[model samples]
Structures are given as structure tokens and as C-alpha cells.
Target: MTLAVPSSAVAVPSLRVLPLRPGALLLELVGLEETLSLYDAFQQSPVAGVLEIVPAARTLMIAYDPLSLDQAELLQAVAARLGKKRSVGVTETVDIPVHYDGEDIADVAELLGCSTSEVVRRHTEAEYTVAFTGFAPGFAYLSAPGAELAVPRRKSPRTVVPAGSVGLAGEFSGVYPKASPGGWQLIGRTPLAMFDLARDPATLLRPGLRVRFHDIARSSMHAVEKTAVVAKPRAGVPSDIGNGIEILSSGLPVLMQDLGRAHMAAQGVSLSGALDHGNFKLANRIVGNRPGTPALEIAPAGFSFKAIGRGVVAFTGAPAATSVTSANGDVASVDFNTPIALDDGDVVALQSPLSGTRSYLAMRGGFVVEPVLGSVATDTLAQIGAVALGAGTQLAVNSENVKKPVLPGEQPAFAMPKADEIVTLDIYLGPRTDWFTNEAVESFLSQSWRVTPQSSRVGIRLSGEPLERLDRNELPSEATLRGALQVPASGQPVLFLSDHPLTGGYPVIANVAAHHLDLAGQIPVGAHIRFNALNAFTHIDFVASDPQ
Candidate 1:
């Protein structure tokens, strides 16, 4: 069923509502002005059930708790705020010194039919406002009103764009925060750090701020050297100095994870926590640690650690071959999902998982690690929070987050799918489902997609029949969520995981149901998946009427 807007409310830049999921909705607007205006209104007076509002170039994604509000109520609340005056707040202007000696400077000038000096002049003269932050932490998309410095992205993106490189693409300009792959047209490089965790806010730019670029000489650039800053554990937390765990060998990088940072999507931060949320909580519960207590999220296989002092620990998630060695060199196999007492000289080792991909280890207290932005979860893409664990890494534990005593006996374990197994996951179609043809949607539900080995905490990249698109135009980047099946131009859909990016330009066909997300995360690489649609595709259209 489609929700239609009132005919009397038709006006310029009409509003349309699209169902993103059961708990989320995407509001389609005309441009940045309409998007930001509504964003400011929601910020000034927030709705009751609205958990987050992520603004983009032409859309606003709103996520809420289904228990607190329904879709019809949310639509009415949003309609009431339309055409409301935006309250202006004090805006800060940041000045960045740039060296205009980029490799693309000449190319950009030639494309604009102007001289290199004119290109530099045009960039430095116009004032740009921070439209939205995405792609990466501290990477803010800047918009310049009435400026003619627009350019297209390169045909092929560079594998490694230098950090702090100023670039322009389409109608926006931005800086690369930490040197990842990019396709923007580089015009210059900046000495100022775009993102620093040591700072109070971490990111240098935010929404509604003004930015100015100044041309600098080559000789002046030598004074400022780019350096990487690591986030340390917050001060004032009590620690057990002598009692700790020391890593002997880690086949893959083990990371500390909790519930993850919330309400930070406005800064391009994703909700990066343990991939298996159910097991993460169960591990902490068995170890008597409170919810949100930091724990070790180990990858499938070869991990060994030694106890510096007496403690209790529990292993959960994927089933693995685990054993413990005593000080006198006696070794004994151990069972999982149960608490094990450890001595000072005891060494515990884990082999490759028999089924799943990730395992969780929880201590009686919790891992003593410094958190970045109130979360211990490491965001691999954004490079935020705790550092990855490797050989020789030592972690302290304390009772600060303990709530109860350790539980006795073993917890029943569920069967995890093996590599050759085929699992079925439920999905809800929407938001961008109309972009695909009916045949494509049917094929998506019928065909079996293999979980490629290229998958990671960021997303589960699938290999299957390419789902053809009905509309192949470039989609403006909009907010994304965990479990979203984002279909790129390659026709393959990437199921976003816990560490997925906040926004993307690809169209999402469906979203995995929330109840089955934990199971989806545990599917081993090479396993096949069949999608079951819970409902048919429905388009929701909403136009604001006179509030009086």
C-alpha cells in the first residue's frame, strides 16, 4: 500500500517518504537547502521516538525505536515540521593553509579553461559551508554558493590518496582525512589535520561551519609535519596493575569491543561493535561483567594468551579447539561457553573455529582499554577507538564494570553454519527497491549468493547473479544502516555489517531483518544465502499540509 500526500500541499520541491526499514524512513528532498532546513528544525525540537537524523545532499534518514513510535505517527510528526524556519546558531570559520602544488592542479585548470593561478584564486576566495560529514571521519563535504569550481571525479581512483589532500568532485569539495582510496580531483594539500582524536570533538569540521582556504608557499610547508595520533584509555579508571593478560600470538588482529559509539553519525562514525551481538552479550554475562563492558573479539583461529595473575574468563561465539597449559607444562583441553579459572602462569591457546568466523573472550572484570568517543569498539574503516591486538600486547582487567558473580555450568550453544551450508535470511524491501526491475527483485530472492572471502567487519560482499537495475543514474550519497543490501554498479549486493559506512551512493534493494542480523554475521565465508522477503515493495509519499 502506498501512502499519498495531500493534493493541496503540492509546492516546489515536493517531499516524498520512502520506507528504509521497519524502524527507519528516508525523506527525499530537492537539494541541500531543503535537507538542511528540515534537519535544523528537527535539531531544535526533536521528535519523541527519533533516535538519529542523518542529513545528506538531498535526503534525510531517520532511525527510531519501533516500540516507541509507529510509521504513521512518524510521518505526521515530520509533516508538522515542514517549511518551519531554521534557527541560526553561531558558526565558527576555520582557516586552512594549503600548498597548491598538486598533480591534478594543471589538469583541473585545463578543464576549467583557466590558468593555474585563477584556479587557486577561485578556491581561496569563495566561502564554503560544511554540508555533511561522511565517507570517513572528519571528511566533511563542503558546499560553495555561486562558485564555478565544479569538476568530475577521475575515471580511476588512486589506491592511496595522501592525508589532508584537498580535492573537489561534482558540486562539493573536501579533504582526505587519513589517506585511503579516493577518486576526487586533487587541487592542493593542507598542513592542518582534518581529524584528531586527542581533540575534544575529534573532527575539525562539522555541519553549519564555514571554512576558508589560504595559499601557502612551499618553504612554509616544511615546518608542519603530519603525524598519527593514537587514542589512549581515558584517565581516572581504576586498573589492576599486576593482574593482566599478555598476548603470546594472535593470528589476526584481536580487538576490544563494547556496544559502540552512538549518536555520532553526524560526524561520519558508524556503529562498530562486535559482529555477533548476541554472543558478545552472553560472553560478558557468563563472566559476570555488566552490559557494555569491553571484551576481546578474536578472529577465527590461532590466539594464545598468558595470565599474569589469577582470574576467571569465558569463551563464547564460534566453537573452537581450546586448551590450557600449566606452569609445569601440563596441557588439558577445555570446553567453551563456560567460565574457566586461570592461574598466574597458565597459558591458554585457541585453534581455528570448527564452524563460525569470530570468537569472544570475556574476563571477570572487563578489559582495561582507553576508549575513543565513549566506545571501545574499533572502527576499521574510520580508524577510531581501541587499537588492534597483536603479539606482545598486554591488557589490564579491573572490577569497575562488574555487576554480578560468575555463572556456573555451561550455556547451550547453537549450531553455526559451516562453509558448505546454505542459510536463509529474512529481508524487507524498500527505500531504493523501485530502482531495480521486478525481475531483478525476484532473482534476488530466488538465487543463492555465496559469501565471498573478501568479506570483513565492514560488509559481507556476495557473489551471485548480477541484479539488473531499471534506473542507472548516479545516486546521491545518503545515510546507510547495518543489514542494508547495497547493490553497486557491478550488480552484486554488499550486505553491510556492524562497521559499515554511514553513507553511500549505491542503491539499497532491501535490509536484513533485525532479528536475524546476529545469525547473518556468523555465516562462514563460502556459504550460500537465500533471501526471504517479509513484505512486498511499497512506496510512501508524504507532502506537508498547512499545520494550522
Candidate 2:
């Protein structure tokens, strides 16, 4: 539905507010410029519980803590903010050198019915503004008024597009920060690195930044490419003594993670952390470490670590068989939620979990690692943070500070599903439920869907009856979140996880409830999942989401 813009600066534009999740709201606005203007205003004076305010093509996503402020109060404040006009601040201009030798340059020229050189001329002459950042870290969508070089995305997305590859789709242009899957029409390539985690400000082109492309000779392109190097790990003063465990063998994509990078969705970063928060916190507390401490997120199993110095440690999430072998050859099995006293040269081994997909291991003082963007969490989708764990890795820990007494009765175990179990999750209908047919929505809730093996930290793909759409119009890319049930052209649904992309161009029928988000993350491959729709607010039978 379209709304008219206000004629007076003090008049508010008609806005449509939709519940994104329990504590988040998706505000559909007039357009990009208005979205950015409101985004700037909110940044200048943010609400108390507002954690992240993400601006998309035509919507603004506000994430908040429900405990700090109620949704009604927050919506009132937003309405008041929209009542007044806000100015977009002045932005910086960045001239980028481009090489007109992309694989699809000639194809794009033919599609536009122009010579390749003229296509290059049109691209170079236009000045583009960074409308928003999404898809991947450092990938900025460039937009300009009265754009003349618009093109559709490729029918088939390439499995991998090289870093610095410039592409265009619809009314926007972007350069891929790293090698990843994409559907944009490749027109040229740039040598400038778009994102560097080692850099103080990771993204070179931020939102509202003006950018212009200039063509360079193929010979000079080599020099420009040489300037783009991976950011080196920054050296830092050790905050703790270099005492910790040495990895004998890291089982199945182990990673060091804390509560991931939050409040940075505008920068194309996802809130990726531990899959199961309940288990992560329980493990930390068991070892006398504070919550948010760096811990080893162990994927289903075969991990081994040797203690360099004696320390107290505990494991949680996904019940698994753990064994501890002392330096004297005394081996004993350990249980979950129980702190294990490790002596020097003690080796700990973890087998595959009988249930669940991942586990958490925490030490008394927490693991010490170089943090990127104030987090040590590894976002597999964005490829941010420390590299995946492997053999021959040596990590340090902080000083064994205040050790809290653990009550015997306080040892709590997290629930995990048995092998090939069916998991039922509650969901709340959209932001975009109207996009799908009524039958499709019914199929989504009633049908039994199996988690495909293609699932990962990015999202869980489910194969079932195709969900037919009510409208065939293309959806503009918008901000996405964990548990978003996005359906693409294939009609299959993909439930997003912790490391989901910041934005997507698919229609989301429903979002898994906030309370069951962590449970959604634990679903293993081949597991059957049934969606039970619930009333959005009243927690009663879900007859209709919004009566109005």
C-alpha cells in the first residue's frame, strides 16, 4: 500500500507500523530519502531501550528491550519524531578507480543496447550515494536520483563473486566486499577494499557517503589491486596472563564466541553469537565466569583440549560424553553443568552430542582473544571475527578472578532433543504475511517440514509444499532478523539463524517467536519441525493478527 507524503514540515507522513518481533517494529516509510532522514533524526536522539535502528529501502527497523520500554510508548515517541522534519547531514565524497573488465560487462552492454565504452561512460559520469549497507559486511548499496543505467539482477546468481566486483541491479549499484553468492549484474571491478575489519571504521563507504567511479587503464589496475590487502590482526596489550588450553584437535568448526556485535546492523553486521544462550550463560556461571565471557562454541563433536595450567571448567548445551585424563593417566567421565578441576597436563575430550547441534565450553576466567568490533564472536556468514578453531591452536585466559560458590542444587541442565526428533516452534505472522496466499499460510503452519541438510549458521532450509504468493511483484530488499521465515522463488522457506544476512529480498511470511528463537537454532539436519501459530499479543488462538 502506498501513502501520500506530507506537504508541511511539521506534518507526519502516513506510516504503517508492523510488528517485526516481540521487541521490534518494522515501520514502512515513503522512500529511501525519508527513511534515511528519520534514521539520522533517531541517531541524534535515540529512545531509552532502542538498541538498533536499521534503515532499509523503504522501511526502518527498530530493535529494543521490551523490559526497558513498552512498545506502545516507543511507537508514540516514533510518531512524535515523524511529526517534524529532519535534515540529512552532509556526507563525504569518495572517488573510486574501476577496471571495466568484469565478466558480464559485455552482456550488460548488450542488454542496455549500448556499446561497452558508452556503458562505462554512463556508469562513470553518474554520482551515487550510499543508500544502505546489506547482503554482506562492507557491501553498500549505491543509489542516485534519475538513474539511467538501471539493470535487473542476473536470472541465475553466481555461486561466487570475487571481492571488489562492482555490480548493478534495479536502481542501485554495489561492490561485493568478499567472495560470496550474488545475483547482481556485474558491470566492472574495483580494487579498493570495501570492508577491512582491522581498520578502525571497517567500511570505507558508509551510508550517506557520495561515491563516483573513474575508469583506469588495465595496466594501472594492477597497482590499484596491490593496494587492497587483507587487514592484519592488530596487536594488543594482553589483558590477562598467557595461561590457557592448547587445542589437540578442534572438532567440527569450533569457534570462539561471545555475545556478538549488536547495534551495528546499519553497517551490514548481524547479531551473531552463541546458538543457545541459555546453555552459554549456564556454562559460564558454572565456571565462575561472568556472562558474555568468551567461550568455545563446539559443533557436534570430537574436540580435545590440553590444560597448560590448572583451571576450573564446565560444558553446556547439547548433551555429550566428556572425558578428562590427568597427566598421571587417570581418566574419568564428566557430566554437564558440573565444574571439572583440571591439573597441569590434563587432556579433555568431547565426543559427538547424542542430541542437539552445538555445545558450549567455558573456563573460570574466560578465553582471551583479539576482539573485532568489540566482539570475539565469529559470524560465519559475514566471515567476521577470529578464524575457525583448528589443531595446534594455543589460547590464553584472564586471571582467575573472584570464584563464586556453586550450590549443589543450582546445577541446571539444558534440554536437548533426541536423535531425529520432531521440534515444534511457535510463530507470529508478519510484516509480510499478506504477501502469501491464505492456503500458503495454512500450509506453513499445518504441514510438517524437514530441515534440509543445506542448513547452516546462515539459515535453515525446509522442503515442503511450495508456498504460493498472492502478489508476484518483486520485493525491495529489507532488513531481516533471526527466525525470519523468508521464502524465495522456489517457494521453499528458509528460517534465518543467528548469523543470517543483514538484509534480504525475499518475503517473510512469519517470524518464529522470540522465546523459541534459541530452540530454532538447535534443530539438527533431518529434524521435523511443525509451526504452531499463536496470537501476537494476547497469547490466545491466532484468529487474526490485526483486526484493523
Candidate 3:
């Protein structure tokens, strides 16, 4: 006889719903099993405007479009789904071959007060299921309930953990798909390719999949290893497109970006796109290209490009002084926000911006490149999308068919942000504020924090008096978003940026307000920032009629 799983009606009451961002909500559930059950139910009957449903250890992050669905209706739909009786589906079991020798093998065994042999036996004996995938593509979080291998993460995380290293921490086991910073205790190493973009599914593991580890002799580790599947060549990027720009010299960092990829977050892809959206859109509009067209996100200063064909070019953001020199030696100064005509072989040079950190350059037609997962945005952290621009890189532009733009008589002007200025950002506290002491919360709001040089597209490290946490427990991995003010063990806060990680273990005491996201992007290094809390009720868009 087939065994029947219990209904989730009793479990539904245990959920704590919290509003996250503009159109997202966080549903804190009891266990990984219930989280997976709700995930399955939502997939069966998805609500309108619900783009992606991401599951974590004990939370479900639901991303929706506010224009199509109201926040209250979305909550009602999800609550109804959880109220129904649903059966957990059959799970696929995968066996991973691992060599027993690792750097932390003896350390882990000593901490658990057991022999190294017993540690390996316990790990292999238990059946672990994949709880979720995050941090990086194909990085799955595995858990074995009612197991005896619970342990604490290292006091300090390694700067770089080698790929294929098997690790364990706090009832969880995972293999690093790529080399990255991690704190999990190393138990062994696996030669299996956990993540390969060339494969049909890309990721080797997914939520709800069963995993088992088998012991393999060190001698056979290389013999049994499988090579990554070869990827098919992508189309759309031609070697010698007629209307294209050849890079003579580029600034320190230049990347191709669009509006970013939002629907692919469940696959561990971040929404890495243009940092300053207001300037990116204005640049495209001035050049008569589509608003979501891929453009060059040039860093402040030292960007020069030669036009291969006659096209209209416009630059916005940072108010950089520009100069255009034609092949005939005729030179003209270009004004910001106004479209400039570029002849064949005309060279354009942009100096350092008087203010601001990033600028956008868009042509009459958008840049044509092979898109990965429906976006041209380059994510430096996740290493997705187009490669970074270099001095000799050739870029193809779709200037052959330019669309006529409808413009107002007066050009729209945007003010640039001044460097070394104190900027106040609106934030919403909670989701983890109870973990901090009252004094810590006050320090977070009143103190003026300086942006550290270590800040990047992933996150901004703030320097200030460390906020004290009342609780000393290790935070479980949970869904994180851009603008999350995550506080680590050292009490320092990290403000997440566009290419931030999908999930993190640090407690996020506050999130930057939705309206201030673009402004947050332009915050330069050495700038001072103060976060002010906004009323929580203002974030939700309540519908006039509630769903029955």
C-alpha cells in the first residue's frame, strides 16, 4: 500500500507573512518539507503576475508584478493554495562519488567527538534531500533531518573555497559548484561537475532531489571524473558586422547592460543590470533606441570609441565632458542629453565626470549581442551575460535600421550626484530586527556610515560603529534582495547591490526603500550615508476588493 502524506492545513497556520520589496513578499515557513510543498502547489496553479517562486531553507520568496496583481490578492491566492490537501511528489535520487580526504576532515571529527571513520559513515548512511539552490548557479543546499552531524561554521570564512569541495554545517551538506568564499566545514572532495552551463538542465541538483554520497578511493578520483558537456555556439554576434564600433581604448571598467534578468533568479542568476536606471533610460531615449536596449555602462573617465558607421549617439549620467573628432580633423564639443551625429571613422572621447560614478552611452539602434537567459546585462559576481569590454574588443551595433524618435522641444535634464556628499536613504526595518538590541537599531538609524573602498557590484561595505545583536545564534540561509542591509557576525552592515547574492546567512535588519534604489546605485566611494526608516504600511498596495 502507498503511504499518504499529511495535509498542509495545520501547517499553513504556522506561516508568518512579511512584505519584502515593491512587489515581493516573504513567507516564513516551518521546515524545508513544507516550503517545498508550498512551492509545488504554487507551481501547479500559478497566480497572475507571479513571475518567480524561490524557495529557501525555511522561507518562500514570491516575486510578482504589481501592475497586474494586487498585493492582498497575491497573499490570498497563496494562502488558499496552502489550505488545500496536496501530496508530495516522488523525488529523484542522485549518487555522488567523493574521496574521503579533505582539509577539515580531522577538524570536523574532533569537534563532533568521534573518529574520522565514524564521521564518514554517518554522512554516507543518511539520505539527504536538496533544500534549495543559491549563492551560485547549481549550488544546492542539502539537509538530512534527524541526523547527528550538526556542527557550526568556521569562525572566519575562507576567502576562496576550491570547486568540488564537499562541506557540512548546521545539519546541511553542500558541494561548491565553483570557487567562492565559504565557511562550511570541509569533509571531502567530489570530481562531479555540479554545475555545467552546457548541460540541458545546467544545474545537476534542484530542490526536492534526493542525494547520496559514496566513498571512492583517492587513486580513482581522476579516472571516474566526467568532463563538462560541450556547449553549442550562440548566434547573433558576428565577427565583422558593418555597423559596429571597434574599441580603441576603454575606461577602467566597461560592461554591456540592459534592464537585467529578473525571472531567472530561481536558477541562481542575479538581476545584474545597469546600476543607474534613470540615466540608462534617458540615454536610450535621447538616441531613439528602445528603453530596454543594451548599452555600455562606462565608469567615470577615460572611455574612447571609434565609430565604424554613421550613427546617432547620446551620453547621459555623470555629466561627462565629451569631444568628437572627425576623420577630416574637424572637432566638435558634445553636450550632455543631446544627440550627437557621428560620421564614419569619427572618434568620440569622454573625460572623467565632474560628478557621479557611472555613465551610459546608447546609439540610435541598440547594441546587438548574443543574450544569455534573455538579458544582455553582465553580472561580474555571477559571471553571466557578455564579457567585460577591453581595449581591442569589437562590438556590433544594430544601426542599420534606426527608428525616428519623437522628442519634446526641450530636452529633459537630470541632475548628477555630487561626490563626497552625505546622502540619506529611506529604509524599511524588520524581517530580522528583533535579533538586534535597541541600542543597535538606534545606531543603525542615527549614525553616519562611510562607504568603504571594498564596495563592489555585489554589495557596499559600510564603516561605522558596529551594531550589536542580542541573539548569538547563527542565521539560517534565507532569501535576500537588492538593497538588503545585512549585518554579519562582526556587526558590520553590507548594503546589497544589483548583482547581490540570491540568498545569504546574515541577518538583514533593514532594506532600502524601493524608490531610492536608483539613487543607492550612484552612491560613490567615500560617500557618507544615513538610513531612515519608512512606515511599513506604505509599502503594500492593498486592493479595494479582497479575494474571497
- How should the candidates be ordered by lDDT, best one leading? 1, 2, 3
Q: Model 2, range 1-548, lDDT digits (tens) per residue? A: 23233344354555677767778778877787677777877867778988888778887888889999998788767755764555556768999899888888888888889988988898999999888899988889998767577888899999988888999888888998888899999887887888876576888888778999999877776422222232122232243464578889865878888888887776788889888877788888887788898998998868999987778788888878999999999999988877888887999999988888888999878887877887888888887887887777777777556367542223434368654888999888887887888889889888989999899988999999999999889988888889999999999999999899898899888889988887888888888899988853221111112213
lDDT of each: 0.85, 0.80, 0.79
Q: Model 1: runs farther than 4 Å from truth?
A: 1-12, 223-228, 232-241, 409-414, 544-548
Highest lDDT model number:
1
Q: How much is 542 displaced in model 3, in angstroms? A: 18
Query: TM-score for all predictions?
Result: 0.94, 0.91, 0.89
lDDT of 1 by residue, 1-548 (tens): 33444434434246778877789889988788888888888888898999998888889999999899988888788776766656777779999899998879898999899999999999999899888889998889998977799888898999999998999888898998888899999998888888887786888998878999999998887533344464554332235455668889989999889988899886778888888888888888888988688998998869999987888899988889999999999999988888999998899999989788789999988888877888888888777777788887878888555669888675634677789999999999978999999999999999999999999999999999999999998898899989999999999999998899989989999999988888888888999999999988877655434434
Task: Supply the global lDDT for candidate 1.
Answer: 0.85
Error of 3 at 262 (Å): 2.3
Candidate 2, run of 10 with poorest lDDT: 538-547
